[model samples]
Target: MVVRRRAAPPERCRPSPYGLRPGWDWTARAADAFGRAWHLADRYPYRGTEFDSSFVGIFRVDAADLFSAAPDLVNPAWAEATGQQLQDMVPSYDFHRLEQLPQVLVEAARESGALPAVRDGQMRTARVCGLRAWLHGYRRDQAGSLIPVDAVRWDGGVHHALSVTDDSTDAELAAAARRAEQDAAARGIKLIGASRWVEQLRAARRTAVREQLAGLRDEIAALEDRLKPARKRRTVLVTRILGWDGERDTDTALGRDAGLSHTAVRTLRTALEADQEDRGGEEGGPLAGLFR
Candidate 1:
């Protein structure tokens, strides 16, 4: 037997103090706002997997509340990313006036299929940008009037898109491009298509470090191999010195012949004596007489 899971309840709309516009369905509006929230998330600056936990209530503002004069955000994602709330920066918004804009109406008409959305097979979505308000997901009513289903709205200070053209002087055009790049960067949007290039650079650096470490390890091993005979010779000399019943001059002469400093030779003899003592000089070992 299969148990079917119940669908989640639709998001409830927060009542606007200014009152919602008539003839708009709450469910449809909420869904549209939900879609816009995802759009905002995709376009949000400083959002990575870091903001995944805050995705739950990102669209806290209802459709009616969005166009209202208030600017406060109930979602913590913006605050977590920017270190401040939206209302802290933008005290108020004039999104209500967006629907009445002439450009918005024209764009709405085009999207609703009331007018041609493209010219010469070029889509208006690409061409009709950098506007104060962008109307999208529009539909035509029985009366042939265009109704915008959703909108991406911003105030005068904020631009929803950036467009640069060569129509200006070379310096002016370059400046515009630079400004556009800066704006996109500020929003954490990649305009130059460098994500793959950046990953490749990181991979190359990692591979280079790995190879350098391997080369260093090989060099260390070779140096260690070269020192093996010298180390073995030193061990034999230490053993001979442990059994030597000679004067200080003779000890010094032996150390000098073995290329060991007098101090180093003395330290080795002391260390060997300590080791033998730890093992109780093992019944007439070389260091037994000295310990006794």
Candidate 2:
């Protein structure tokens, strides 16, 4: 057997653009060291760190702010480190929602004895908070990157807002959303608790119901087509029988076996004869046109 040795990745010692303290350079170093492994490995193992076991969340920095504030430092290498380093190094931090961010940061700061800071000259705090709310639990995968968690599909807010089963159909979801809406309205509460989730549920239900109704309409048409021959034969027979007895009221026996009322049987026979005449001539029997 022949064995081929794998070559190690080229070493990178690029200076931090974020003006990092000595150990904090781990971000860039991690990108340099672990980027290939994360990209290439189907299942990359998490490297246990003091942060991982303690539930310590990484202090997230805005890539946009980094780009705007220090445009000169926004090279491809820096971008790669900024985007992938923390995500690869600390999966626990990436697993949380934005609503949990304040608490996560607070806990991390308390444990680490270092508080997260925003530069005074950066965008106003209100803008930051609003933007964060708009982007809560949002992550998108870039081309050639690892498959990302579909944030909307796995939204915690939806799970907490309403109870749903795995097998819940669109109609069931719609009904559940409507019930939830009514409950909220009764309590004078806003149904915006789940961020347009109710609307989405309703839309899904409408689409499903429309599809089901369309399918049923097709089935009904096919059944009517199959019943046409039988209906024509019944009409011809009814005409012959009615000829034998001119008293239509005495023909209770006509519909008794079919579980229909005498009046219903008469109505059906009349309609069938009319339909046959509309198609052209009644070709069934000699008495076919006599009752009309």
Candidate 3:
């Protein structure tokens, strides 16, 4: 008898005022508002991760009412890489006119081949970037006839097909050659091809760093080896000084040997003596009467 484990089920999309809803997609909504955000952000810049997190807050109230529950719907991985930024320092999303979340989610889910046609999948990773790029290619007027992403519908399916460009059908190749010629004239760089120039620059930097660091590392290793015996000697001296019970000159002599300042040696000696006294140095404790 063979038993197989079942795949984990997808997240449910219940009706709520929050991050994700049926017809609303916060990621796209956030990206759409980004242009406006940048226009206003000319006055003040997004400090750090604030712009990313701000979109979530706006999405919660404006897009889906996500603040009520499961508020962190704008996954961090997507939000940070996403080019969207909030227009206001504080979010005041005005998406009520465009609000049709459940329907939008249903359509997105259908496009993505989700069973029962639920909500949109996480759209930030490169996995869905192709879909996003394709969607944005169409004008708003052309949205009605725009192709969706269903495998069954085979919409925008040519992208999935691998088309080799023979010399006869090499339009992109010809365009690239023209661009290269123009660029070579305008900028006296990349004459040997852009990719080759980039690789050469990278290789040169790596070689320089590796060659310099190899000698530096060897020098460091040699110095560390030389210091090993000295470290042992220092430890032994510190131990002996601690056992000196209450000797003052022993400390001075130890400092001279250790190449430490006399004041530092005196301080160490005082501490050891204090420690010995605390541990009954007057009664010939193991740590007492070393130099005395």
Candidate 2: segments with Cα more than 4 A from true spot: 1-151, 155-193, 246-249, 258-260, 267-292
Q: Candidate 3: where is the Cα deviation over 4 Å? A: 1-183, 186-190, 247-292
- In the predicted model 2, the residue pairs found to clash are none
Candidate 3 shows a clash count of 16
lDDT of 3 at 227: 95
Model 1 residue 54 CA deviation in Å: 40
Instruction: Superpose all Cα atoms of candidate 2 onto the true structure and report the RMSD in Å to 1 decimal.
Output: 17.0
Using TM-score as the measure, name the better of candidate 2 and candidate 3.
2
Candidates ranked by TM-score, best first? 2, 1, 3
Cα-based RMSD of the predictions, in order? 19.7, 17.0, 21.8
Model 3 lDDT vs. the true structure? 0.39
lDDT string for model 1 (179-251, tens) is 5445554554323312222333345556777899999999999999999977776667665665564675354
Prediction-by-prediction clash tally? 0, 0, 16
- lDDT score, candidate 2, position 148: 30
lDDT of each: 0.40, 0.43, 0.39
lDDT of 2 by residue, 111-178 (tens): 77433344552221111111121122122222123323222343333543355544466666666656
Candidate 3 RMSD computed on C-alpha atoms after optimal superposition onto the true structure: 21.8
User: TM per model?
Assistant: 0.27, 0.33, 0.23
